[model samples]
Target: MTSPRRWTLRTENTGYTVRLSPDGPWAELDAWGPLGVEDGPSALDWSRRTHFITPADAAPAEYLPYGLRPFAGADLVASRPGEERGVWWDFEAVEEAAGSLRLAFADDVIGLRAVLCYSTVPGTDVILRWTELTCTGDRELRLERIDSAGVTVPVSGPARLTYLTGQWSQEFQHTQLDLPRGTFTMGSQQAVPGHAYAPWLAVQDGASEAAYGVALEWSGNWHMTAEAEPGGAVRVRAGRVPHEGAVFLAPGETLTTPRLACAFSPDGLDGLSRVWHRYERHLAGERLRRPRKVLYNSWEATGFDVDAAGQLELAKVAADIGAELFVVDDGWFPGRADDTGGLGDWYPDPAAFPQGFGRFVEEVRALGLDFGLWVEPEAVSPNSRLYAEHPEWVYRIDGRPARLVRNQLLLDLGRTDVQDFVIATLDRLLTEHAVSYLKWDMNRPPTERGRPGADHADHLDLDAQHVAGYLRVLDHLRAAHPHVTVEGCAGGGGRIEHATLARTDVVWPSDNTAPLDRLSIQYGFLHAHAPHVMSSWVTDAPGVFDPRPRSLAFRFVNAMCGVLGIGADLRAWTGEQRAEAARWIARYKDVRDVVHHADVRLLGTPADPTFGVQYDDPAAGRTVVAALSTGRLDGAPLVPGRPERLRLRGLDPRARYHDAESGSTYSGAHLLHYGLPFAWSADHDADLVVLTRQ
Candidate 1:
């Protein structure tokens, strides 16, 4: 019998060769071509290549080079090229287990070292240190620098870093770098035009200045490769400038670069690291159980008019429907019994629940469902208690009141007091209630921008500061809670970044709950992220919000591809509708393990008239195929003729399987090589086929 040698790795660049051995501790890495080669044609000379051009010639200096320098305080000298020009510097690697590699070089003019460590996960994390020394008239000088430039600088300085550490592929490039998950560029910078600098220089009055202003730029990219074994092939290419880092040396100064480190593992330690962060940042680890599947929410059902009895009624229906979680969405907080009042107050509204929130939570738990509460903690209503108490906490314009979004004001998360207040409030809620899940929400953009107690002229940069503060708050939450499953919601899908994903277990794909709408959106999202990270939920009655016939089924099917949950009122569903939901839920329960763990195959592309998603459940020895026809010819038979047989992938050919829908039998070879036939009509645009090995 031939053992499964199903996965293979290759690269486009011939300069590198990767060897995989089952017994080797790591895949072998051999030198590939002299990539980034310039036969006098520099790497920066990509103007002739259409793929390199941007909509504008001067692309924003989003990408930059950042590194660390060692012996920052030392002075070094170099000889001229050809006349013993090269200078040498020696340094020792500290904590090799930290995974950093350092290299140094020196010449007649300058001495330098480059330390680089690529992470094994999806995110940016490259640490660099650079040091240089020069002498003038027998005087020695030392230079040290760390690239902590702000994001506005063309060099990105770390904000634009993409999460791409891990087994990743870029079209023809393959890679298996040992990268830690969630590692991302923390700082970067790019050279601004008309401001380039040349390393050649002289010293005057204690300062050694160089000629030629060079453009320095910095940007971060993400990567995920299919290569897992050692010696896996990968290719990388980057544009170059007129000169890399070159330093001018006086007679006797030495320079050093910062030490670099990175760790990689086949056990997915990087991903686990990010998961640990997500747990801590979102306070999910403290809640020992995974979030429940069937969740009932009051967003559509109650809106802002939620009373104790109203909540209890919904709780009863949720409990009866076997829903595991019930969330009291918007309008629960102080002065918020209606939409007009109470923006920032964290206290519960007395009118809505006369008995208080603790009693309400007890009542809900008594009905056999866990309680979840919604909080737009980042936004404050104009009439909220907190807003009244600390109006200065809201972002406001000079001599102007704060602008409102959805009748809310963006909270100033930059202040330590603000962060501490939010943390304390959340901690109180978690400690006081049986809250298992949190629908953490952000409803507004930063508008008014003023530093508290500062004059109107001292306004802050709202955008950058707010974004950074949001990350800080998320980090604080995760560190503090560590037990609750936090659901990130940015008015829908606005904040879908790798950093956000690293801090939260699930993200709402969008407020557009229609299954058809979600299919493509989810597809686009999955292109860069894992499917399990998405939270796809059912919401509202079909015609009320969505006018599609199979709205329910469509939502269910779309959500089946990700984490499953419901946000609508089950009590409003008829017996038949409830039964259908129950059946679908059971079906999900039957195959969720496989769907979550299996390798996915996109059978058809959107560019094609038809779209399909297929999953091969190796553990269950089953395969499920889902297809949707976007455009169909009129008068086409209800069941189209000669259905295209799909050449399925990611399956074991030796396994025998029987179709769940048709009882058709076939081996993996017959199913994958020959393909499966799917019949459908224009009205019935979507179909699902499941095959289980018998």
Candidate 2:
């Protein structure tokens, strides 16, 4: 027989290979990671393990197929008459281009065609995969489960599943579980890529230092399922959640799944994480190089009591402490005394800003700081003038009572008028004000999500479309105002995802500024996202929510790990505290480039409350490690036997390094193995160690 077709895709230190048999139509993952073979496994031999009657060579194991043959986990599921109500795509053609591969499969029986796309970058060990399905038949078809990508992992022993789980103030807490014999599924149906669980998953065998993972690039409700087949093999599939209903496709109609990013690592979880960070950085592109200026937000400091004079005082102190951007949040708008009013009214509140924002902007600029404003265009307050003027603009049924959260109702952005108003208002704001930044906050979830004319039952689809419309406005606004930077905040961090991050410059990790609580929150966050785009603020030491007072140094060090911002009421600070903060701000500037551009490694797991993260910039020849003690550092140690030393990684082992904090010199080997002693001298004490290669 002719040699079976084989292809190998290599990325840095990893490789992915797929094998196809001339006699069979299925595409099997021959090898992944370091074990990937360059030459063909052309024999197509399975006699060594086969027990039942062997299937046709054309129908080998499928990585992405419907209930055709004995597929483990189908990537595409469809129904048609006379065919067991499933899709069976026959292999047609395969094309390879620069750093990309395309495979075409068609099921003439149902007139459906499937095209799978795969691509990889130069320096990262990740493969981006997504599928496009086209209907060529004259009849309609129902698509039940269409996944972005599907891959089978070869397992020799027990495998563990690692995923993220958290809620509200806390997000991306990593959770691991041993694979069971049945299907394990996780996703978000909350209309937003929620805080409860991140859209990333990995199946790893630490024993072999082998792992396979995938992250979906979708923002709305999505699903991922890992099925452990009867054998030791496991199949993973991911895509948008079809909870609304099976999507109906008419003749000549086409549908595309969200891109699913997959990565393989032979160096365990840390390597896999580093690969993901690099991939995200590559995706971020120019944003990574753009300076993430230290910003000062007047939310925790002033709340709804915003005014020009008070803000000017805050802006002076903020600029004094090295803040580059000054943002007035919430109360700047007309009728916006609090969350209950002044949402849709995008204009400045004439009373609070008697001189208008132009004066405030000019004063802020005079202090050498840029200006920003907070706006929630996707929502309307029931008490606002905009609501009274355009009641039908908000999401509601003709007779049903409008559901309110945080005294606000969600605007149906799916409507063209809403999208137009948002674009025009934001464009005007950028055109008129010298505003350099915008804090876009979505404080509430969608309720009564139906359009004015659409049926209530179709609201789920409307929710999905609303998110698209929101993206459209952002796209247009960004295109029109390229100089303006936007920060995404859904209350806090609720709207963080690949889809939203594509347009916004930064994301608010959480609303909770409590340093102690943020330790875990930030740790969970970096598991899937990068640090440069994560907006962290050093609010008041005693935090608005968690009243546990922490040292200024502790708060500063903790917040310094990400895009540093200060939200505290600086006007109330003592002279000594202000001096101390100035020093820390200077220190953060000293390391901001390294922290933002380096490869991030989350060093500790959630079970270990005393976790830390390391940032390494090989080109800059420096590394920064920030370790935090989440529990009480005052009365008693929470973990009585917690390790006092933190062994750093991603360092050049042969080089000599200088510890700037201790003014001590040590070999890289010593720092890697012996580690620096974490002197948790006080309650909630945080430690930051900067190592410079000498």
The candidate scoring highest on TM-score is 2
Give candidate 2 misplaced runs (Cα > 4 Å): 1-4, 21-24, 35-65, 69-71, 80-84, 397-399, 455-460, 541-548, 605-610, 631-643
lDDT comparing candidate 2 with the true structure: 0.77
Q: What is the lDDT of residue 431 in candidate 2?
A: 83
**How displaced is residue 279 in candidate 2, in Å?**
1.4
Rate residue 215 of model 2 by lDDT.
87
| lDDT: worst 10-residue window of model 2 | 53-62
Per-model tally of clashing residue pairs: 103, 8
**TM-score of each candidate?**
0.63, 0.91
C-alpha local distance difference test of each model: 0.48, 0.77
Best candidate, lDDT: 2
